[model samples]
Target: MSYVDGYVLPVPKSNIEKYREIATKAGKIWREHGALEYRECVADDVKSGEVTSFPQAVKLKDDETVIFSYIVFESRQHRDEVNAKVMSDPRLNDMMDPKSMPFDGKRMFWGGFSPIVEL
Candidate 1:
């Protein structure tokens, strides 16, 4: 089964384009370093829930939208290897600064998952 790393964040509407540019560059770096797939998606049909939802997950605001992203790898070990290389890649240096990001890095959440089923 493939291992996956997923991310959810809230990006300001005014900064979506900038976020996209950064994500594109980051995605390319991840792919180049052996990520099987890299995808960044903006919220289109999501809504804030009473208890929990994509919006609530990131404490989304009126001026912001949710971003859901994921990266696939052959396995946990493979993901670690790829991420190690990605972290050391010089091309990502500019994007590594939290202060320069288009969104609130403090609110961003990410996790690794082991797929139990794929069909």
Candidate 2:
């Protein structure tokens, strides 16, 4: 099964363009390091849930929107190897710095997953 790294974050509406620019560059870097696929999506119709939801998870604000993204890898080990390289790339230096981020890093979250079923 393919391994995947997924992300959810809250980005201010005013910073969507900036966020997209950053994500595009980051996606390219991840792919160059051997990720199978990289995808990023903004919330269109997602509504806050009573208990839990994308917006709730990110503590989304009225002036912000939710972003959902993911990267596919060959396996867990492959994901790790690719991430190590991506993290060390000098091109991502500013990105590696928390203060330059388009969104609040403290509110962002991500995790690696092992696919259970795929057809």
Question: Which candidate leads the pack in lDDT?
Answer: 1
Q: In candidate 1, what are the lDDT values of residues 2-75, reduced to their tens digit?
A: 99999999999999999999999999999999999999999999988888999998999999999999999999
Clashing pairs in 1: none
Clashing pairs in 2: none
In model 2, where do residues sit more than 4 Å from their true spots? none
TM-score of each: 0.98, 0.97
Tell me the lDDT of model 2 at 117: 96
Residues 1-119 of candidate 2: C-alpha lDDT, one tens digit per residue: 89999999999999999999989999999999999999999999999999999889999999999999999999999999999999899999987688888899899999999999988
lDDT of each: 0.96, 0.94
- The top-ranked prediction according to TM-score is 1
Error of 2 at 19 (Å): 0.6
